[model samples]
Target: MLRGVTHHITATREDGTVFEVSYGYGARQRRLLACLHCDWEEQITYGGTRHKGLDHLAQAHGAVGNPTMTADARARRQVLWTMAICFLISAVILWWATSRT
Candidate 1:
């Protein structure tokens, strides 16, 4: 799952059997998909860096592992803020131009 982009990360035992973490802040749930003994697929939205949410997909129900195992949430908070700013700016400009005519 090292294809897209990396997110917030946490290291665990070297056994490679740790709980993987991925934030999936979908339009619905801010899910945290935690995979066990494996990786996950992720994507960056908005600011092209900050992530939307998290998804946790545990290996097995009550599997033995650590929460500090997940790789890392690469995106940052700035991304979201940046996106919000741009959107607000665009909205203001659109409203202003429309009201003029």
Candidate 2:
């Protein structure tokens, strides 16, 4: 069975403390969020997990900063960019071919 892709959101304090929250869908397609610094987790049936994670970091850990996505999320975004470029190229080629014919 293929595993679901997991992405992490990290926050840091000025004191150099770091906190991370991982959010992703499970094998059964249930959305899950878990904090790396503590025993805090939630199976989200609705709403956004990112806000929840940010809230946790700010409220529980007092770590406030612009959260950053981990490599997995960046890779996913890269895939989207690649796909959009490929689609645009194909559209242009199709338009050129039809114009010639």
Candidate 3:
């Protein structure tokens, strides 16, 4: 089983054939971009997997669209943002309370 954050991208070609790509870390913690429709795969080295995956879809499969992140990844990002905001608010409140003394 894969163990890390995974984001999926899907695109449909002119013939209505759909292709999907997965961008995420593999079990060994290496970032990867893999196509579900073919044997194409790339080990991401510089964090441009999104563009690479989209390019593959358009150039190789003649598919184009605005790729979207998976709901789970989006939810995880939202949770992290919420936690950061909460931490900031709590820090401000603590500083204000301490400075009042």
Candidate 4:
């Protein structure tokens, strides 16, 4: 189920250190972010992947500020939000129907 290309990120620290990060629909089609440096990795189960990745970069690697969300991340977020809204509407409709009957 990975339907698109995986994003690869490179962050360089002020001390000239570099880190490699890869995130996307990874193994088992789960969204994940993994750092190639120092064993920092996370599976994005909730919230924003960009935020988590940026946090890791800033805190661990001394990266400056948060980086913009990649195109893939943005698209994924839109899809997730849309699905969530649709699910909420469905649940509401189900509740209303049940109450009416």
Question: Please, what is the TM-score per model?
Answer: 0.30, 0.56, 0.57, 0.51
Q: Mind giving the per-residue lDDT tens digits that candidate 1 earns over 2-99?
A: 32223443323345322334444443443343333455444443442222221223222222333343323223234546878999999999999999
In terms of lDDT, the poorest run of 10 residues in model 4 is 64-73
Task: State which candidate has the highest lDDT.
Answer: 3
TM-score of 1: 0.30
Task: Please provide, for model 4 over 1-101, each residue's C-alpha lDDT reduced to its tens digit, 9 standing for 90 to 100.
Answer: 22333775655567744455677776778788887676886888987766677778878888643366355445555676898899999999999999996
- In model 3, the runs with Cα more than 4 Å from the true position are 1-5, 67-101
Across 25-61, the per-residue lDDT of candidate 3 in tens digits comes to: 8768988888887888888899677789888989888
Candidates' C-alpha lDDT: 0.40, 0.73, 0.75, 0.68
Backbone-clash count (model 2): 0
Ranking by lDDT: 3, 2, 4, 1
Candidate 3 least-lDDT 10 residues: 67-76
For every model in order, what is the number of clashing pairs?
27, 0, 0, 0
Query: Least accurate stretch of 10 residues (summed lDDT) in model 2?
Result: 1-10
Model 1 scores worst on lDDT over the 10 consecutive residues at: 48-57
